[model samples]
Target: MFGLQACAKAPTAAADAAKPAAAAQDDGGYPLVTDVRLQNAGNDDGWLMYRRDYGSSGYAPFDTVNAGNVAQLKQAWDYTSEFDMGHEAPPVVNGDYMFITTPKNHLLAFQASTGKLLWKYEHDLSNAGLKTVCCDVVNRGVALYQDKVYMATLDNHVVALDAKTGKVAWNEKIHEQDVGYAMTLAPLVVKGKVIVGVSGGEYGARGYVTALDAATGKEAWKQHTIPMPDEPGGDTWPKGAAETGGGAAWLTGSYDAETDTLFWGVGNPGPWLATLRPGDNLYTDSVIAMDPATGKIKWHYQYTPNDTWDYDGTNETVFTDIDYKGAKHKAIVSASRNGWFYAIDRTDGKLIYAEKFATATSVTGPDANGKMQTDPALRPTVDKEVFTCPSFLGGKNWWPISVSPQTGLAYVPTLHSCMTIKGAEVSYKAGLPFLGESFLVKRDPAFPNQWGSVQAIDVNTGKQAWTFPSELPWNSGMLSTAGGLLFSGSADGYLYAFDAKTGKVLWKSPQMTSGVLGVPSTWKVGGKQYVGVWAGWGGASPIWGGEMAQDPKVKGIPLGGHLYVFSL
Candidate 1:
């Protein structure tokens, strides 16, 4: 049996936003992205942030080119990252300049209209940094604010660089690089705060989210995921392991400007076993709403308590307003790694409803709060191996799901995979991927021939609308336009558009040399609308490339590193 731990004190807020004095930096507050971050303010440009906005809907309201002329979209230009790995960064376009980050942490500013390299910034990441990265070695993307671009390095340092000159400005060490912690998600800027989360929950590091003074590089606040004795969540952890309890806050978060709340998704608990440290871990594998001004958690809902299958709830918690039972309510939706689609009241973190979108047997019914009811038998034992429906990689990984408010549904690229899990005694050693033992298993048994799929789900009804199977698993992030069409890339190097109502493939073209893995973006440039995506194959699939390599369909497809922009 797992030992229930004591909780820690609720993490404290560091900065006082009520101070009327001017910031120490030259500017009173952080500058806004005049040409980029707010580009969609009717100027007709490109996507600025991961998930398009703080909402993480991956939906752009622009619909200049709809289903009729989408077929005419041809390649506008292609820019190569040259470093390869996985080109997962989405390009942010301002006027004519497009900013992108490579997997190796090289920041580049390119000509959006013509594929011309303007400037590239490369950080001297320590060799030690390379060794501690637990997953794919790459940076997800960058955040553009004021006239500077902010990026968190694999070495756990958040560095601010001149957006135009590509020159380093102020740099601060956010976390120790030797602790197996890193940053891969794009930094989110809310009001004047630059918010970022740590990665390495799988590697046994404490998970937390930090807010920094965007202009002065001053520490604003820090919120720990797990709790220690005397803390609000201290009672949720084992007696003494709360400090080391893993609850990594990865991926970007959602912002509710009306309520001044920031909603971020938290990753799995440490050690990969419930028996190691028991009790419902406070914030692990949960969606938490925090006060951006003070970093105090307003409310939280744990998606998977004492998670043993590694089903992280750290995907985008997309903000959307829906009519429930005839009344309109603000809501946030997430397709968690636990293989369930959930809708919650964004205002107070109350469970509205949840349904399994995949073949999940770990949970039977909904808890009183509407969360999936977990089967106690699914929890791993010291000497027993348990096979779960969706493996540690999750039914849905980091791929951003596209939500069409027009159709009131979300289109997701779901993975039909499972991991054969077995827990072992593990010890946390700084600077190494923490875990005692590993497992080897097949992903999908029923449809071994199919690994990936694009499924349309009705957010209002909690039912799958349509399913479009992919030859390979883990396609790419999705982008939906007002054109009544959904755009996404596949591991087969094909960029496709499917009818939003019905899962029908309307058009597809070979845009990348290898399988595509990054999210897709659409924008209007030169009076013509264009769709864009980074083409590179890297992620957990490639990390377990040996298992994926056996699939004949994705067998010969090489990895690619380039950005393809299409316009009609």
Candidate 2:
């Protein structure tokens, strides 16, 4: 009931993102993805959900095709979706079945080893949906439960489908699409509940996360990212400002079964002009740890208080134990969009160590109490334009970071750019963009001319170990393996396999049809390990990236929706 409170327009949404199944080959049996099985999925040879496990590490345990044989990798199979827009999903596989989602909520199932299309679910979106999504129409991936495949659509829908037939099972509306609310992150299925987060903060929509009953599609629990008047942290926002204060929980969160905690990242505050709402803005740019069953918030940590540069803290939280100050502590690490990397004590929400991984000038540093201290002179105002680092697209964004148990390092796809931002006067209208600011992405002369790179951070010390720079913004998600190999794609259309310990590129795939915006995943079928990634040139960097998008090297990248699988 704590949804949009702005008095402007009516809003509503649908339940499902599927329909009549488009048959391909014979549909296979459903892959049983139980809560227990998913609990140990990080050690499994399959990918059951987004980022493969509750850790949300974007890593797999397969080692058959690794650094030793990566150079011999050859195309094993390939498939293309009918629709093309930012193809952000990882090639998710369970048993011998592979599931992938394309833009506009299309989910396709295939015979894992042979690339034979099994069944396709083409979701039809209303024309009104075009006005909802703030970024490209992208679906990260699908969730595989016992007998169902789950997807959260861009039209603010939570849908369940028959895993074997791609037939619609149940569909439930999360919010009114017209209210500027949409769901792009893949549904996280935990203990019979389908959890999803809302986006569209730019449109002034209040953000929240909902958990639908996996069997019936009924909402079990819901929690708004922005605190209410009587709720905890409500004092952070003044008067009625909390109603439209955007703390969009835009990314799928990491789960810790050991403590029964769900660590979700809250995005930026709305109306970009921070002075308009005042206070630390509560949970806006922070991570909230909650109970998975009842949606009760336990502890929260803020990354950038009163964020005005659009530096959303909605990055995947990777769980790992880090050694700091001569002691080993369990932590959750996030490479925040505000240009800082943080490792917080997962148990108590205390800062263990905070480090700068990119060129940043917006903040002075973290204070004794761990609050991020900003450069007051750099605050963007209507009369004063200020230049900042790590542009709004982030030092790193929702592309996801993978932590490797083998390397004891987190592999991050880093974007290096800055912005010149200025505040503007704006008012909220139902389903309309609410950002009260103007900005342009640009290069920072203080850093190298490179726009992106893949940096490996030493978890123990919270220091960057090595960097693999790119000519273009590295938008692809990173995937690490037990074989001591790290895999990631390029905006130039090649997939490279690097030695996880060193930053040496051991193997690079031939150029594909377009730049890569998809995350890479690996799984085993019939005892053979295979690597897969989607080739498509579309994402926020090219859309919101102003002058940077017009760079000579970035101008000609083609659009596509091809899923390519490789094997040694």
Candidate 3:
């Protein structure tokens, strides 16, 4: 047995709206999931995946709770997780059961309509995985296939659980923990294959995404993000540099079902020192579009070439159709840690528009080839310390961006910060951090008083619509809806709803147990739409936010986790 039935909490929120959801649950169980259903998550009633759809839009087409009645939103129910390190998992819903993962790979199942606990599966972990975790011990969430719930554990094992009984179906070890590889991504399942990536770029692990048979848990194919000595990108690096070149695909990627393509973002190159290996690193700090069936690279677009500031391109690439300059485009966008909001033509992987969404001052040009030109002087060096905007924590880190097709704007969870960085000498070890750079996170010089913002950008125009400033880093993931509402959370402990069009605060929930670091999601049950988000303060924020983390305002905030659901 992978799990022992857990105890439930009191004061459950009755599903007054369960009448409409009766049609969804066949036999009073989770609705049978299919590839077509996962592709149509935008039109569904449950928060299905990390972004709710293949596009990673994080937008739901529910209007029952719109901007008009948002102010009346109240807590429907809440659940406290077993572990409190970082509840970074969003509530992945299917029928009446919702799922979340706390730090340390503990999976919690819940009654979606109420706050009752269903079952909790505590993953068995070896101590080695915790040694090389670059950030906190966090698991993003889980993926639900036909009947199995899948999660990648911190020890690099992908476990498939019976969605109903919480029993272990199969557990596959993706990689050895001793080599410094770990799995924190929520598995992405499509066409019967579970796709997941590894995290250990800082530990010199060459990154890759593997596809497994969803039902059997057998390996299908694996494609590495960093190329080898004989590969096409071999010439881009020095001799043998590709061995630990560092292009970890650390986050869950977005998919385009129509194109049969998988878009995965590659992280920063090894050592964070351009002088170690020359040329534009082929896929590091780039987005690679691959064939889902074979894991073959179809097209790739580099965001920051020769990245030396730890500016990872490993942020989610969200798909949203947009009208740009009087022409409609099938576009994919990303709010990168480099502090740039980029809109790309998904069809051919070309840059449509790239605009600065936060404090960014290290690089400038994307030339005609869609390549970023790095500012040589601003880059950190062995002997020179350089101050740059959007620090390594990023203008935005792994916290996701949400795009609303209704408004044609991307709601960006942003960090208004900068850093002073310098290069350091590093040697590759089997299971050690290889970040050959030193950085001290600081406030953005342009906005000295503010550390973060909810930046809404017009995707079509590559222009800013509005921004909501914050006293602390707004590291929570964002959600947009057909309700004309934008939802996100704050480091100061409030879950906020803003008018998507004008950046106006529609509702702000009372302070929760801790800071909101998990992504916000929306699902409909009993015809009533509920907003779900987890609260916890562990990520790269407090761990890597140097000077800023020590500030009186950010220091000693809190450290715990809780799940909150709100409905009007």
Candidate 4:
């Protein structure tokens, strides 16, 4: 077993005074991140959000570190955080400062070029019920706007910090921490509002997305992921199940500037066994399109209605234009947890194409209207066990997929595993897990010796273009570049750069201290381009997927919190 490193001490006043005067001058006069700024973020100098842009393109336009010269890449700098738990937050880069959050809600800022500690803000959450968090204690990342950096905390609060200094400008509580409500998703700044979602789907917490005033920490609007009795799609839920019906919007969502709509994916329903909740359970496993200004649902598409297999639709949704049926269509594509890759019309929430991205035996395919045609025999029952493909983690999870306009393919980080699920009786408790099912996950025999894959799918045809396999389940999110490089980290601790056109591995780094689970980001500072990713491993996989986590294939991987930056 790997030992945990001692936490790094916070910089003292004397160390701050000894810094060079030019450190402050490094601010590059970055403009306020508005809708226009987010739309053009691919060409921007810094990584601004979770997926680096509002459309969630995850493509960096910088070309200084191309495939030809990527072999010469070296570690420019690294920062080890204090916490040893999951360090999944993608470093948010602005002008000169880069911001990141770690376990226990510790936020740190560093010099973008030198990795110098700027400041740290440790939030006090003594009253929070940390045990209620279903997965490992983790924060996805942060959002940046005018001069304030927005982050959702694990204790159900949204905080705005001064980007220059790590001081809190305002803090507002969004939900009660002890009631199975927490925030793990990065707050997204959409049209001057900080939009965030809640976690605790396992605890039967009713999920919702709330928009807070960016300038002030006041609530602007709130939209429940589960519908009320009088609302649309309400009849899908049982008489009173909507009160605790889980539809957590826990992953960062994407935006469409052209339509002024926000596309957010919803998670699974509570009491994991569908037999307990009954009905279709509206909005739980669905993608909702809402007006960013008013938080009104324009339309929604449910990926897994009556989801019995614990398939959550909280994966990131990528918005792009694709040629569908010999015509160009604005599409929202998702590698769904139910093992299907779907391309829906972003303008009207109509399915343009749907196909399997992973092995899923429970469903034959989509029906004429795109609803999943679930195999009733494969559904779990109270008295018997049912085998299902893709496990509960789905074909993918919160780890993001990148849609590269350069290659016209969506690079998906996928897992090839299945589960045997058995249902049981479960009672709802405020701060306890409401899961009514037990599952054991294992790698599918068809994919022997391979549990992870980075698949490049052609968006136009909804087919796999190429695939790169890994021995362990891939946990890292993807970052694509115009320089013909696709970057993804692995559970084995190596950050790999693959040729975007083909799945050939161009360059890979020596194994680091821990596995790489965080998303990768790229930015340019001082005329030099750098790629950065967090190296730490601990998420839902280790906590929930027992067999896969303890598999001898990945026993060599370690757990530690370190940010690695590489440059050519």
Candidate 5:
């Protein structure tokens, strides 16, 4: 845990002076959000990545439309992704152009103001990729650096495309799909290097993040999440299983340029069942800060050690400066899938404090070291169903969380459900990967109303500031603005606006879509600011096929595949 004296310092670097930063050419325009600091993964211009910024705050401080007349917001334009598994691409906006991808891997370049199609690139990934993907087929989005766009396909290839023309500049293979590896996360570009991580935590693949020369597509660095035998953190896992230990950094990570540290949140261990691999899984289910220059780990803080609940720590790591206990502190905050909101000292990767943000009945509290209080009773077992709060699905899934330095509040989209998990364990064999079976059980009486909640917490106090209730899961990422409003979407097809100070529902509109799982982004084009979000459903909710499928209320609403933009 981060002690009282462990205050973080901003990584060294002057603010981008209207030029793209890093290894790419300085575009002489607004800097790119190469790291994880902005919502839409960059600045407020157009969302370049999943978080809109490297901090993964999901918050945009721009406010052309404010509380005074947010109800007047009207549809600016709409773009249909044309493939309907799940529209998760966050649009990357530069000047008047916006580029986005669909769940089926269709990349489209559009006029940001009118949604006029510039060009589209559809990738025909091999059918072999279908088998490698554990869940539904989907792409998170793409990254923009220099004059090119970078994206990883489900077929396990990283392709660089010219930004002005949707043409492939260069394509390279980071991993092959044959060994049960699929690349779905967005590629991150920093300095002159493009960094990407492999997915398939559920498929028992050796996870690693590879850095490539952005210009030549040459290998720069590769940091394996799972350690080799005799290497550091190697003794934690069973002999040869380290390769399949599953500490995938599948989601987008944040970067502190001043410290030269890249912060990545790792996923859960493989095979789900804890009895297979023993010892505290070092890098898995933890946040590791690495040097972007050499990919060397600087510091790490584990959220769940030897996790059995399938609680991956692969959510967004939001970086911000907060006034804590009358002292200014550089902090990294994350709303973890493990049902806890953690604030840590980013500079040294120290756990500052953690608070339960949702119904987490598995553990009582953190131990003296600030690690999660592991409950032996909640550990998975064969044929014996143990009810666990926050389920494997978690108190919070991958929907992005937002932090407003203006309001001093962190907004989180949360779930309040639980599941009964029975772990049927088996031995791990090469090529066979891992064998474990688990199913969901819903027993709580308050399961329906408790399904979703949007909470605003005071970062300084580590307490709830306000909350907005939801009839469905809070499955969408949040966006906050200087206009004193918070914007978030729902699986129920409603896009909502709430007061930043009070959790008052100021306005609501039916984006007319189900299961909106992507991060919403906003930007100004033609001097008129507009808010945008991809409204198509699909993600982990289908895998369980439990409450969301059987719930008598929401079963009728079909999935969606469209993009919605709004303006006043």
Candidate 6:
């Protein structure tokens, strides 16, 4: 029933007829989001992009919903999209309008102050092979630039829509859906270009990042994550395996205005087994910095070279200025999937610090160069089974972390699971799963009942300030506010408010339908502060790590498709 209508135009007349006169108050005029607006996005007015701003701090400066008054918050409004797949997109707010995307690539615009539907645009992917998608049919969100909204579809198409009217302006096919390429990340609008990345590392597709003209949808530049034989990191990969190397830039990247650099994390190499593709696998499990204008790699740092445990480096590279080694440094930090937290100098890609944040059994620690001190015995072979910590679900997945400059701490949502892996013989096939390993994911033996945690790490010292444990793995991302509160949702259907200084749960409310898989966002409208998040329980964990999903802690969570908002 969801896909029955190919392109259902929003009934504008009916929506206008239902609007209440009292809800039509003009706080300000809707203006085009320019470079200036993006740089100042953290100001108390609106949440402009996926992680609030180009820095990906995920922190809001609004204090209306501070620690003292957050307990008095109540649901202001609720809206259900009724499509019922994973609702992972964070709502983007600009002036009085808010935009959000649902599963299957349905973009909806609504009045920010009042829950009035402005317009809706649903992309039709019925003819595309839905089964080819490695994960569930999920979308992260949309980007707003000059009067247009940009969203990447599940079928590997980047479409630009007129922001005011929900009309398609241009649609460009970035990758072939038949060959296991899809785009689920929200496009990042940098200067005049819309940047996006492809998905499907599990199916052996070569990954790439492309930039397109924001106005005409014409490709401006493209950068392949996997390099050829003569490329810089080519020697790290086997002779010809670089052709299908799996360094997927599947998540949205962050930008540094001062350096004119774009930071993106790459995913794991092909075939979950390590022996099949020998060597460090080049840049697969690495973070790459590039020049946005030329799409040329500036520098790269590999986190888990020749990663065999399926540890993807596609986590957010949060940019912040920290006091490291008793001196102030411009740093980019990440709570990596390999169960370690790393801090690097963004200007030169030099390692500042690296430490384990979760139960990592495969890695002992970081060496002088910050590369993991890997245990050779932990590598699984075709003839032997090996148990490794921080399972394929990762110590942390694509869910975002919030960094509060006010508190000088990074709030990380983490998974505390492990896996037993055994290699199997397999051959490469395009459009088919190239993973040559069998794995059973489970919670760590020491803490079999606990599966998730929210860790507050002091970015400067690379030390965890405090940790808040969860019974189930966190499906939601994080939001930090000037009120000294950290907001995050969970697989148990509750959106929690925590004290930023201490790991104390101040308040929480049940979402009532399903787990919260989306990130939380904050914005101010009509002088009132509001917090919002999408309630839906679907993502890679449920699809790839089926055993972990069926664990007693998370088994009762149901599917959902509703947007929950609260205010004082």
**Per-residue lDDT for 401-459 in model 4, tens only?**
99989899999999999999998888998998898998899878779888889999999
After superposing candidate 3, which stretches have Cα over 4 Å from the reference? 1-28, 127-129
Residue pairs with clashing backbones, model 3? 17-526
Error of 4 at 483 (Å): 0.4
Name the TM-score of candidate 3: 0.96
lDDT of 3 by residue, 1-568 (tens): 0111122236446322232232344454557677877888777788888889999998899999898899898788887666657667889987777888889998888778777777889988756648888788999999988777999988888999987779999999888886778889898998999999998888888889899999998999999998887887767778888888889898998888888999999999887878888888778999999999999999898889888888888999999888888888999999898988899999999898888888788978578777777788897778889999878888889999999888889988888888899988888888988877888988788988988889899999878899998988888999999999999988878889999999999899887768888888988776778898988888887888898889887876677777888888
TM-score of each: 0.91, 0.94, 0.96, 0.95, 0.91, 0.94
Question: For residues 2-115, could you state the per-residue lDDT of candidate 6 as single tens digits?
Answer: 111112223333222122222222223345777666766667377888899898999998898999988998777668777767789998887667899999888999876666
Q: How many clashes does the backbone of model 6 have?
A: 0
Q: TM-score: which candidate is best? A: 3
- Each prediction's total of clashing residue pairs, residues at least 3 apart in sequence or on different chains, is 21, 6, 1, 0, 26, 0
Q: Each model's C-alpha lDDT?
A: 0.75, 0.84, 0.85, 0.85, 0.75, 0.84
Please list all clashing residue pairs in model 6, or write none if there are none. none
- Estimate the lDDT of model 5: 0.75
| lDDT of model number 3 | 0.85
- Candidate 5: stretches off by over 4 Å: 1-44, 429-435, 441-448
Worst 10 residues of 1 by lDDT: 14-23
